[model samples]
Target: MELIQKVLDQPVAVSQPASLRPYNSKLKVHDQILCGKIMHSNFSKLAYSIMQSVGYVHDIRAVLFEYMLL
Candidate 1:
């Protein structure tokens, strides 16, 4: 069987908290918004940058033969 990526790497500091483990479970967080934080996670920041930069430059249509392209 194929293996999937682990969500978190080994914690770098001995003082890492238990709450950090909960941050690795992503299926629980899809499509939800984050509010009122001093800073966001790096992954979340990259995602927002991608969405803002390349989000709506393509169009989709349906016909006898339908397809999606970018």
Candidate 2:
């Protein structure tokens, strides 16, 4: 009963809300690599479609270069 009373008398520790925490803007190495891969995949698909519609085909590297220029 005494131990229980002591515990009860102690104050509870409250954690701050998530919104109060600072945001981490940095991405991990693996996360950065994955994002790059996803972006490259999307750009490749878009370039391929555009080339097909134009009745011409070019190297994937050239298409990617054009996209980077824009």
Candidate 3:
């Protein structure tokens, strides 16, 4: 009861909601899935690039393949 009273006593601040008119929401399920897969692959690529930058001789493709196998 005290918590509820405290919450009610606090002043409420309202912010304008974001407008999403510029975004596309009609994407297919397969497209969304493919986008997710690409995003994951990009993360691996980024890791591979970081590894190469740090002088690791490991093959990125091999590492990515092993990741897929799991």
Candidate 4:
């Protein structure tokens, strides 16, 4: 993975593909979309884990709320 700065301020690290083809989108450094999607998915999992650790509400409700926030 190659770490690069996005828009001069935010630093977003992204995966660097093994090879680049003419039509392949992996070479495009400007697109932070793949990174963003992975981040969101990971964040949701973390939230659910935190909720489960606290364990105030029922297990089902905690999971529902965690997904609903996403």
- In angstroms, the error of model 3 at 20 is 49
lDDT of 1 by residue, 1-70 (tens): 1111221221112123334434433311321221103234544333333333454211211110122112
Provide the lDDT at 26 for model 1: 35
User: Model 2, which residues run further than 4 Å from truth?
Assistant: 1-40, 58-70
Candidate 2 per-residue lDDT over residues 1-70, each given as its tens digit: 6644543444332133324534232222212222344344543444444443454532333444545559
The positional error of residue 69 in candidate 4, measured at the CA in angstroms, is 7.3
Instruction: Write down the TM-score of every candidate.
Output: 0.26, 0.27, 0.29, 0.26
Between prediction 2 and prediction 3, the one with superior TM-score is 3
Candidates in order have lDDT scores of: 0.26, 0.38, 0.37, 0.36
Look at candidate 2 and tell me the lDDT of residue 13.
Answer: 23
- List, in order, the clash count of every candidate structure: 0, 0, 0, 0
Q: List the residue pairs that clash in candidate 2.
A: none
| Two-way TM-score contest, 3 vs 4, winner | 3
Residue 35, candidate 4: alpha-carbon lDDT = 36
lDDT at 59 for candidate 3? Answer: 40
Which stretches of model 4 miss by more than 4 angstroms? 1-40, 57-70
Q: What is the lDDT, from 0 to 100, of the residue 41 in candidate 4?
A: 52
Which candidate wins on lDDT? 2
- Candidate 4 lDDT over residue span 1-69, tens digit each: 121122223333323442442323432321223234434454334433444345532344334544544
Q: Pick by TM-score: which candidate is best? A: 3
Q: Give, for candidate 1, the lowest lDDT window spanning 10 residues.
A: 56-65
* Candidate 1 local distance difference test against the native: 0.26
